[model samples]
Every structure is written in structure tokens, then in C-alpha cells.
Target chain A: MCLAVPGKIISIDATDPLMRTGKVNFGGIVKEINLAYVPEAEVGNYVIVHVGFAISIVDEDEANRVFEYLREMDELAELEDETSS
Target chain B: MARQITIEPVTRAEGHGKVTIFLDDDGYVRDAQFHVTQIRGFEKFCEGRPFYEMPSLMARICGICPVSHLVASAKACDQLMAVQIPETAEYLRRVMNLAQLIQSHALSFFHLASPDFLLGLDSDPATRNIFGLMQSHPNIARDGIMLRKFGQQIIELLGGKRIHPGWIVPGGVSEPLSVDKRDTILAMLPEAMAAIQRTLDWFKRTFDQYPEEIRTFANFPSLFMGLTNDKGELVHYEGRLRFVDATGKIVADQIEAEDYQKYIGEAVEPYSFLKFPYYKPMGYPEGIYRVGPLARLNLINFVGTPLADAEWAEFRELGRGAVLSSFHYHCARLIEILNGIERIEHILNKSDILDKNVRAYADPNRLEGVGISEAPRGTLIHHYRINEDGIITYANLIIATGHNNLAMNRGVLQVAKHFVKGDQLQEGMLNRVEAVIRAYDPCLSCSTHAVGQMPLHVELVNRDGRVVDELTR
Candidate 1:
């Protein structure tokens, strides 16, 4: 599974932004997301998006938790040795 | 430390990608990563543009699958317009879609996926190409080029140009299907059907040699998604979304195309620009599903055409219920080509298909609307909320490839685990990875806009600074 990355939002504007909605930057790439679902979200908060919809609120801590889980799972042999030996 | 084998540009596929496989000292499988490097932000760029321009602009996304983007983008615009298109217009669109299926499938089987099947997977890299196939089986190469051309010609006749035709519009097509042009297309159906039959016969002769390939290596159980008629018949132009398990049992059937958001959700990964989409209720990897020709074949009981329906039966009897062999993706394409021919013949024969009242009228007043269609690859949904004046306020495109992203990653990993041995990485291993990609026949241009000018970096990086291994294709 591809985990959602944490990119600090650089800005959000109310004007005629990229898609008439606000445009948010994920560091390098700027993605245009629908505002209907998250009309209350601000420019600074991280949002988890898929197919251009912000589905959930994502913080740095939650993003880190996802990474930690993957890191633990990556050490497949270590876990196998601990269990079998 | 382990030795890393990196294959850059993951050859014989649609987009630019790389595969990295790690092997431990004793030659045991460690890990694998398939990285897609390009990011074409069509959705971001498409913002603020007139909705009508999307069909033309999005068509330029991929040279190979421009028809798919054109169709989906036009259909989305049509939804926003809220116009009842004429019956003839619908049939014209169907003709275009069927043509697209034929050509795109030909490109996949003949050009991209053929090398593995024709020349054994272990064949020498330098000689394992279309030319290599031409060295022995010259007839197949000629057949592929012609069959693919017939598909392109169908698009040209209707849309004014083959690659990225701009004829399909928000209300309806820009023009009607002309009598002369329709006759020309009708004349070619027999030849196209003959070509498909020849290719299928060739596949049948040599298919048994690759039993291991037919069983695993990108072949696994997953939910299948495709557009089917309300009666559960195979449909390309208009239908509801149907989901079936690997066993061919209905999981969630009769999903209306307009109400797309209720069941689908998208997820992102840090490693690639592509997004993973799954069934919302099932969640994440477990909810992961497969789309495109193989999935379409799996989800439907009978193809619309008589010939294709018969082949569908022969395919199921092979014990791969809803055939899972990545290799049979070629077989599925042939079946679709046959179906496309039959569908085109059926549509052209309809007098209303060429009726003069092609365009419809709509106010384009809706602030929010969703358009969904079965792209040749899979289910494509374009959801947009427009301003009062019909200017697009927001856009969300759930591309077919995006829906298949999880399956692609898993297939790559599975193939790596199955074929890549510890001591050495064989040519077959690399072919298997490419095979997974070929199964989807993805148009990365349509998924993301094409960033053709920039060079991409594909290297195996360890935790330390050293670059372990890499080969640029």
C-alpha cells in the first residue's frame, strides 16, 4: 500500500485560485482539491487527499506513526528470528 | 550487506518507471520497490480553463491512450451541461470507444507485452523485441500493425484526427457520423475480425508452455471492477459499476455511475505520484481492486458479441475463474477487439446512429456534478463543482490507473518475490515486472500530464550514501 505523505501546506486563497477553489502546495507540487468537503480547513493544516479530494485531516504525528509502522514491518527477518528461534 | 539490482525505465510499458530488488548475501529475497518518477499535474493545470477545452487538452496527456482521456473528459463536461444527448450521438461515442479498445489492446499485446510470450522470457535482451519476433514470426508483426491501425482510423473518421481527437464535446459530438465514413469503417470490420481470430489462434497454440506464468506472478485474488449493462452485460459506453470477487461472485453490483463517491476512496503513498483507490467500506490494501481488460473479463459472464462470449467460456474453463494470468491480458485484448468489431457493426447498422440531430442543449447550471464512464482500462470518474456561470470550481479525477495502483504495486512485489532468485536476477524476472504493467496498459499521460523534457533519476539507495545498483533502460 502507498502511504500518504506529509507535506506542509504553503498557502490557500479564497480568490479565483487554480480551480476556483484554493490551491495548496505539498512542498514541490501544488495540488488542487475540492473545497466542498473541507470548507473550514485553513492553509497551514495538512490534509490527506486521494483523487484530488481531501478525505481526512493529517498531522505530522499521524504521518510519523504511519512511517513507524512501515519501519517495524520492514525488519521482517528480525521478527521471524525472534518468533522462531 | 545485500546486493541490489535496479532496472530503470522498466521497459515495454507505457510510462517511465524503475524497479529495485534487494538480495541478501545468501541470495534470498529481501525487498522490492517499483518507483514511478514523473508527475504530470493535469488536474492542477486544468483549473480555471473552460470546461469544453478539457477534451482536447486532456487528450494530449498520452499519445497512446488519448481516446480514453478524450471520452472521459467529454463525458464529464456533458454531465455538467445536463443535456440529453441524441441517440445517434450516443452510438457515435460508442463507436469511438470500441475503436479505442481495439487499437489500445493491439498496442498492449503486439508492441508491449508480446516479447515475453513470443520469445521465451529468458530470451536475450538485445534480440527480445518486435524485430526479434519479426525474425521468426513476421506475420504476427504485420498483423499487429494493421489491427492497431484499423482502431486508429475509426477515431480519425469520427473525431477528425486519430491521436487526441477534439470532436467529442460537452453537449454531444462536434459532428455527426457521416454515411461515407461509416461505410468505410463497416468495410474494415471483416478484416479486423479476421486479424483478431488469427492472433487468438496463435496464442492458443503456444499458451500451454507457460503454465507457471499462467498461474502466478502478478496473478492473484482481488476485487474486479468494470462497467456492465444494467442487466450485467459487458458495456463500454454507458453502464453501472460492478464489483466481483476472484471467484466471480458479486461483491457490490449495480453501482450507479453518477453516485460514485458513496463507495470509492483514494489514498496516496510517499514513494510515487500515483494514488491508490479502493472500495471505501473495505479499507486500504484489503479493499484494493483490479481494473482494465483482465478485470472486465473477470467481472462479466458474457461479452456482448457472440464470438467473444464463446471465447469467454473457453477462458473460464481453464480454472482461472475470472482469468488471473497477467499473460492472458493479451487474450482479453483479442476478445475485446472482436467485441469492438461486433459493437461497431451493431452501432453503425442502427439508422438513428447517423441521425442529423447529434447535438443537444443544456444550461450548464449545475454547481456540482460527476461523470463516470468505462474507459478501455477501467472505471473513470470525473467529479467537478462548477461556479454559477459554468466555470469549473473544483475537479477530482479518479483515473483508471489510479484505481489500479495498489494492485500494480502488489503485482510488482509478488512478481519480484516469485521470480527474482537470491544469486542472480534473470531476464525473466524483469519481464515479469513489465508483464504486470502491461496488464494494465496504463497511459501515464492520462494519469498525470507528460513531463517528457525532464530526465528522471532511478537508482537503488541504501540507508548509507552509496548507490547499490542501477541500469537505465
Candidate 2:
């Protein structure tokens, strides 16, 4: 079964990566997740959590770049609408 | 003395399962059984609940591929309401379903199965896992994470959350796709495309390395079943039922979802909680067939997308008939992911994707309804009988994993016979047995509607039922 959720890490509770635990915000809700699988994840970083473990850290830049592209597309659509009108 | 080998709570799969192998005195495997150990009784508990709540309720069956349950359950409720869903709603549902497939398949291939592929099946058990994969091949692992994220992000954009999103409802979706969400999903497509293509190339190159595995991992003649469009192209969200034999000949086609029970029969086994679904005409056990990626690829004529179609062309060449080996299920998953990405992009570009007319409101007109769709694993059928008050009286779910029960059992025996030896229990031999089951990528939780962890323990017992040896992980 492939159920996992992306959450932003709010705080780290442990120092050792293998024993690392953190509170992650899933949209508005937050829960403590194990960060052993994502050693590089830190406070303010987004991680993909599955069954209580952080499986991977999300690439914030890559995510933002997609939104930036979407914004540009919105601008282009507006220009096309204005020209047609 | 004759002995029995039991592998309990099979690891790396979605839910609790175990394998029991009976070995003759000399240590040769005589027979094997794949057992589903947990049961949730979702159907029984669903009674007395409002029919409209079925989608969200059914979505709780499994965390993985909840969208498939949502789609199938919603479709059943639509039939109960007797209203045709809007075109945009259907397209939106299709996009979400495909997104589910991509994410689920990625989890199967990358997180669960890749470690076995990258680190040889005989590799160190302690290191043979996703973490091991991340340490050894970070790039491949990253691609898998990204690909899965791409799917989850789309789902979150559309359904409002990554798992069990309640956006899909009876008759239609809760909301229409917004311009920003549509464009955002489109923007993510290029990266997802590259990730799948790269993984596909790597898998194709690595495929030939496992000749022996290809020959024995559920490599036998049986029927393959899945959903197909009118043109016989690949379809996942919605389509007519199709069954093809091992030789790739159409045994049954265009079967209505409502008529599924007439063609398929559910048989119970004393050994497992999962039901054995077989072709009705052929009868129980003998009507053995497989569903999921392998069966889907076998049943379809083409994948529809350019990149996936090219890979599918090569996949079909693996077998003269229906590609009997279950080992290739991994390869089939990669191609499907590619197809899902392309299909999602195509659906988003449709003019009506952002249309406001997406929901169809209607009261219950039908007391009995059947909904069928292709889940990430295989064909998922949700049937319900409701009262005049719109309360469900009965519900039956024949999950994709349940359909492959017989094949998975036979596959376990096949792998066991080939690799398992007398009293001595080698880790590799047992790993192969589990590998064969993993090839099916079964969600035992989905099949039985059960809940549990993925932990495995195996035991070897002598004829007197005495425990001779054991392995636990």
C-alpha cells in the first residue's frame, strides 16, 4: 500500500539521526515522525512521511519552480484572453 | 519424515501474510500455501451506513491506492443514484486514479522491491531494504521518491490531501479543477516523465540478468484480466471487463461491471482470510487467473502513450503468449507509471477540465449497484445492496489482491520447488519465496480489508509437527 504524506518539520526532538524524531505539520495538523530515514532533514524542511517514518526530504526549490511556471502560464492565459477580447 | 516450512507475516509487502511449504522427507518442496492472516470485515461494518458515505468509508480499506477504492465505491453509489456523472468529473476522477496508480506502483517498485533487485536477493538481509537502496544508489532512490511525490502532489492538489482525500463522491467530484492546480500539475509532468523514463531504461537493461527468476516466478499458463477501452487500449479508471488467456486470445470481452458475478466466482480457502476469485465457467481453483500489472499489460493491446507504448512493445515480446512470468510485473509497473503521467497531462489539457458543471445530484433510484475499476494492483469490484432509505444493507469488495490469490499461491509453490531444499533453510531460498509474492505487489490489507504491520517469521516443522528450524526478521 502506498500511503504517505508530506509535512514540514517544525522541530527536532533528538540529536542522533537514527534516533531523530520531529514534529511535522501536515497542512494544519502536526504529528511526531521518525527522521531516521531522512538524515539531512531539519527544522523547516518538508519530508515525505510514511507509517511514522520520514522516507524522503522534499525539494522545496523544485516545488516552488513548478508554481513559478504555473504563475507564468497564468500570465500568458490572461494575455491571450485580453488579445481575443 | 515429511516436514512443513512456514513463513509468517511476509515482509516488504503491504500487509500480514505467511507462506507454508510442505517438504518431503528428503527436503524437496511438495507443496506451498500463501496465507492472508488478517481480516477487517469492512463489508460487514458498512451495513446500516448511508450509501453516500461509501466512498470515504471504503477509502479507509488501505492507505495505499485509496483513490482506487474511492473511484470504485463512488461509481457504485452513482449507480444507486441512477445519474450519469459529468464529463469533467469523470476526467477529474480519471486523473486522480492514474495519480494513485503512479504513486502505488512507485512504492512497489522503488521502496519495496528495488532493494531485492539492486542488492541481490541473496544479499545481507539486514541491509536489503529501502535504506540500503538509498545508501547504494541514491539517484535511483531519489527518482523513485520524486516520482511518488509527483503523484502525491497531484492528488493533494485535487483531493485536498495525500491519502484518503474525500474529494471524490457519488455522482461526481466535490470540486472542479482550478486553473492554478491544473497548470501546477502540468508543470510537474516533465520531471515525472524523465524519472519514469530513466527508471524504465534501467529496468530494461537489468531485466535480462534474472533469467532463472523470470523462468520460475509464477511463470505458468493462466488467464490475465483487466479493464480495456473499446479499442482494446489500456484503461485504468473506467472500462469494460476483459479476460485474455495465456496465449493472448480474448476469452471474454466487453463484460459489464454489473455482470461480473456471473463470470467470476469467489471461493474460500480454509487456510487464508483472502478469497480466491476464479473464472466461473472454468470453476474453482482450475479457473486460476492473475490480475495486476502483469495481467493488465497482458490483457491490453497497447498502452496509448508514446513512451509507455514503446516500452510495452518490448514487454510483450517477453512472452509469445501472455507473458506468464510474474517477475515481469515490476517492469510492467514502470510502463504503467509512464502511461499514467501522459494520461494525466492529456486529461488536464482538456477544455472542460476546469468546468463548473462537475457534479450530478440525484436520489437513490436503484437498490442494487456494482462498481468496477482498475486499481493499482488490478480489477477492483465494489458491489452494494441498499434499502429505500439509501442505507446500505450489504456490501462485497473483491479486491485486486484477492483475485490474484490462486496465482500467488501457485507462484509461491513454483519458487519454493525451484529454490527450497531439504531440512536446511537458506535465507536466499526463503527470500525467493517472498520475492515471488512481492512480484504481485499484493496489498493483503486491501484484499482482506485488514490492518497490521509488515513483519515476517518463518518456521520449519517436521512430520510430527515439531519445529526443526526457524528464521525471523
Candidate 3:
């Protein structure tokens, strides 16, 4: 099982519909994720990924809410360091 | 009748591949070649990316065993940062790796190679798929799905999804396992073990049916390479590389991941996009060796678990030296599935697995980092060079399929020479050629990571290169 984890899409490369990919930031780590599955997803939107493909999109508030929980847990140090204030 | 036969667009694999058989004037097989026929520029495309993104980015290489790439890349990033990951993180990662082994081995055994074994290699192509297996042996098919599903559930429980979960990151995992996740895996242990055991028992009982395959299927002496724990036991995620010669003698032991270049060199063939990784001392072609399940089983003396250790003993008794027949890769795979269950259970029972302090964060302290691990297929090495800005300057990946390319070519040639007759062109005979490649369970998708689909087309040509026969499954 590889498709797990939610990351915010920082940028989208829609040059090719079949090969639509985007840069997603998972906390501090950034990866090129396929956005073909979630065609409506855009930059700043959060998507759940499997393999290289984004399977589903989550609301901005929900994605932020999880980060808020992590911050509360004191497990967001990596993000606190890398993410913009 | 043609003097040469080619099988293109071979079916039942992740991506593209093809096989060519050269026949003499007598219509007998003379030479054979397995062509990957795909290209992936991962090295070139991945340059300039931040070192931290290595794990998540490289995980995109193969959907089947992305965890292998994830963990290995994370280790390389850890090396770059010179950080010591939390103990719990290592344990969680090891469990995930074993889960990956279970799911992937199940896929290879049940979905890919079983139809040939169970339905008979000569079985009709249309009825020789998972559906056919379901029609005849529903229990086996069901068990296979459950077994694969169990592996997937474990992954989902630990990371989140099945394909390329971003939970495993640089330094360590993104978070620790919960009490529920740990308990859920533990509860399913018995069922998982039983399913694998049934398949193993069935395979052993039916071993007598394919004696010809057992003998001629890539049965030769080259070398076996795999990772082993310090005490020389079966290791997947982390261990030193060990090389054992054909006769089961250790050629090189405890080779460091950082020193991989000194022992192994990558050679390129114009026919294949995948690099032929060979032992440096022996030189190209001559230094050909095999990796993956069969090689791992041959290289390790102990499995270090209860159920799998028993199976390991039996597997060893089959061959006095190395189990040269690639057919036993099936047996090795089943044993690994059992080993994986036991190993995962072992980790689950460990104390302090739920500790919150899993990641070890730091800045890049080194310019070069090499991460090595045993993927479900075989040994996978990820080497990277990062500049001062922590962006990747160079990236090289030696996938397990690439490592076995040399042996795979040899295996195809050997099987083709023995079984293929141009005038005959029997379906069973042709299937055997593809079966040989399947035995290695080569992941063209993972190895090439290139573009486009490869339809396996097997073509037969006359002395003047005129094609007369072709087979595509």
C-alpha cells in the first residue's frame, strides 16, 4: 500500500492531460505527484496520494486542521522550520 | 518455418518487455535475448531537487514496491544529514518493508506466475489467467487475494494508503504507529501465516509435476547477492551486502553501502535501457550474478524466525549448493512471505513502538550518501550527491531488476535453447520462455521508469531475417 498521506499542492504542471503532475509539499519534503486522477485539484489544494497519483482531494480547512493537530502535538518541528510563517 | 522467433509485448508484467529467439537452419533454437525496450531518465530528471525530497520523489519510480525506494532514499537522506533516527522509527520501517515483501511476493506468485504452474504451462492462453485460476481453484485464488490484502492492510494501517504513502520520510517515518494499528496486525498474524502455509504445502506437493522446469529453468552457477544482518541472517531493509558464489561459498561479506562502487559497476547495453550491474572484479558479462528472492534464499544461512526457518532448512536441502533453478524463486517467495509475517509480528510485540520521538532532523552534513536495501525483487541501491544548497546534483538508482538483467538474459537463452523449436511453435513451449522471465519477477516499470507501454511480441524469423511466426500473450 503506497497511496497514503495528504500533501498541499504547491504548483501544477497541466501541460499534458495524461501526464498532469504537480509539486506537493508534505510538511517540508516536496515531491512531483500525478494529478490526473484529481483533475479539479489546484495549487494550495490538499490531495491524498497513492503511488504517484493523487487519488482524492481534501478541503483546505481539513488539511490545515490536521496540521493544527500536529502542531498541538509538538510533532510539527520539521514544518515549523521549513514552512513559511 | 522461420529460423528465428520473437515474442514481443509479453503479458503479465508491470510494464514493457520482449523476447527474441534465434533459430538455426534446422529450426532449432540457437540464441535468445530479453529486451527491456523502455527508458527512464530518473537520474537526469531528479537533479537540482532538494535532498530531502529524495524519498518521496523516488517513491514514484515503482508503484509495486514504493516503500523500498522510500526507506532506502530516507536512509540516504539521513546519511546526508548525519542523523540517528529514533529506534521506533527503524522498527516501524522494518515492519513496513516486510509488509511490502508479503504483498509483492503474493502478487508475483499468485497473480503473475501461478497460472503457468497450476494450470500447466501448456494451458490455453485465454484460460491461463487469474480468472482461470479462480474458475479451477477458487480457494487458492481467494487465499492469494486475502494474503495480498492482508499485506495491504498492514501498509495502510502503518502508513495510510497502499501505493506510495509519504509517511516514510527523511531521517525517519512521519509518525509513530498507534496501539490500534499494532494490535490489528498482530491479530491477523495467524490467518496470514495459514494462507501462506497452505500455498507452500501445495507447491511442495506439486513439485513433482514440473521436474523439467525445475532442471532447465535458469539452472546454472553464477553468484548470489543479498543483504544479511551482522549475524548473517535474512535481512531486507538494512544490512551489509553479501556475495556468495555458485557453490554457496561467501565471495565477499559485509560490503558497505558507501563502498558499493568498488565492488559493483554498472554496464550499459544498447538493447536495454536498464543497466547491467556486474561484479567489478569479474568484469562485464562474465561477472553476471543473480539477486532477488532466489539469491537472497541462497545467500542466507538462517531466516531467524520460527516458521520460515523450518522452510529455509527444506529449501536448502533441495540443492546441495545454490538452488540454481530459478523455478525455486516461487518457493523462496512463499518462504519470504512467511518470514515477513513472523518478522512483522516480532516488531509488533516489541516495547516502546508507539514512542512519539520517531524522526531525527538535521541539515545536510555530507555531499554523498548511498542507501542500500533488499527490495522485494532483490537488492536496491540509491546513490545521490547533493551540493551545499542541499539540492541534488547527481542521482543514480540501481534497481533490483537491473541487477538481475544479466542473469535474466542468460536464463531466457538457456530456456529458449532447450524448449523452443521453430517448426513446433507449441503454446506450452512458448509459454515456458515467458515463464523463465516471470520466475525472476522482473519489474520493468520499476527498472525502466521510462515512458510508454511495451507489448511483448515474440517473433520467429528465417535465415534472411524474414519473420514467419510471432506470439503475443
Each candidate's DockQ: 0.02, 0.05, 0.03
Please give the lDDT score for candidate 3: 0.77
Ranking of models by lDDT? 2, 3, 1
lDDT by residue for model 3 (B300-373), tens:
97999998999999999889888889999999999999999999988889888889889998899999999998
Model 2 lDDT tens row, B84-112: 99999999999999988998788778877
**lDDT of each prediction vs. the true structure?**
0.66, 0.78, 0.77
Angstrom error of the Cα, residue B245, model 3: value is 0.9
Q: How many residue pairs clash in each candidate?
A: 2, 2, 31
Model 1 interface root-mean-square deviation:
16.4
State residue A52's C-alpha deviation in candidate 3, in Å: 18
Q: Which digits, one per residue and each the tens of the lDDT, describe model 1 over residues B1-473?
A: 12223222321112456666665555555666666654434355456767776676555433345567677777777778877778788788888888888876775677556766788766765566554665677778668767877887788788773335667777778798778998999998898888999998888788788888877757877888988887777788787888888888888887876667777888777876677788887988689788888788888867878888888788777645567666676787788888888889988998677788888877775666666777767777777777777776687888777888888777877887787654455555665676666577655421111111111223344444345654443
Interface RMSDs of all predictions? 16.4, 13.2, 12.9
**Model 1 stretches astray by more than 4 angstroms:** A1-85, B1-15, B22-27, B444-468
> Better model by lDDT, 2 or 3?
2
RMSD in Å for all candidates:
14.5, 11.9, 10.3
lDDT of 3 by residue, A1-85 (tens): 1112467899998985544678887666576775644567888988755333454566665455444533432333344446656
